[model samples]
Target: MLNKDCHHNCNQGNCPFAQDSNNANRYVCLKCGVEREINRYPSGFGSIVMLLLSLFIASQLLINWEKQDNQPQSEPAISSLR
Candidate 1:
């Protein structure tokens, strides 16, 4: 069974984990341990994905802005006399 005191941000007023720790029990805190493990070795995929997503958004905005700014020039001011 998991120690209630070891839960992430445990706030139970009567958690045994806190009492156990206070009594000098050295059992590891699984919640904090798992978080540390994940932080210590997060996957590279997320970073790559975020970078690509931002670049794609910027490119799309640029394309839209360019289209808006590139209005065609008006026809020649003078045409052959009818």
Candidate 2:
């Protein structure tokens, strides 16, 4: 039999899995009784590769902008009237 408070709501504000279990066990948050696992942050070489790729894209965009800014505009040629 579940406790009066053990009527696991699992609602948005009341996450049953996040609460203390019968055996005093800690569980992850749940959405509508469904258990949710905590997501771990990226580490190791994957993070490094992502950082390098982002930097390369940013640098390329910056270089393109600089080139466009430095480009010179041509003036229209005027003809002399006889």
Candidate 3:
């Protein structure tokens, strides 16, 4: 079991680890005895999703670049004014 204290500084409401600390709000992790801001999303899932998305996007971009490079460039049309 982890013990947590909330100092009531969080405006997000319904914080699981917040307690009223007189006039100021602070967060304390009961398990580790560390005080800090809590993130809205869990770190593990967010990091994994971001990593996969980046890899997919990068691969798509690389494929497009390779296709473009393999294509021959056409000469520009000559202007009569030149």
Top TM-score model: 3
Better of 1 and 3 by lDDT: 3
Considering TM-score, where higher is better, how would the candidates rank from best to worst?
A: 3, 2, 1
Give the TM-scores of the predictions, in the order they appear: 0.37, 0.38, 0.43
List, residue by residue over 11-67, the lDDT tens digit for candidate 2.
335654665464333355554444443334435667899999999999999999999
lDDT of 3 at 55: 100
Cα lDDT of model 1 by residue, 6-73, tens digit:
54563443322322343332333434432112234345877998999999999999999999889786
Backbone clashes under 3 angstroms, per model: 0, 0, 6
**C-alpha displacement of 11 in model 3, angstroms?**
25
List CA RMSD, all candidates. 9.7, 9.5, 9.2
Q: Which numbered prediction scores highest in lDDT against the true structure?
A: 3
User: In model 3, which range of ten residues has the least summed lDDT?
Assistant: 1-10
As for lDDT, the candidate ahead, 1 or 2, is 2
Instruction: Specify the poorest-scoring 10-residue window by lDDT in model 2.
Output: 33-42
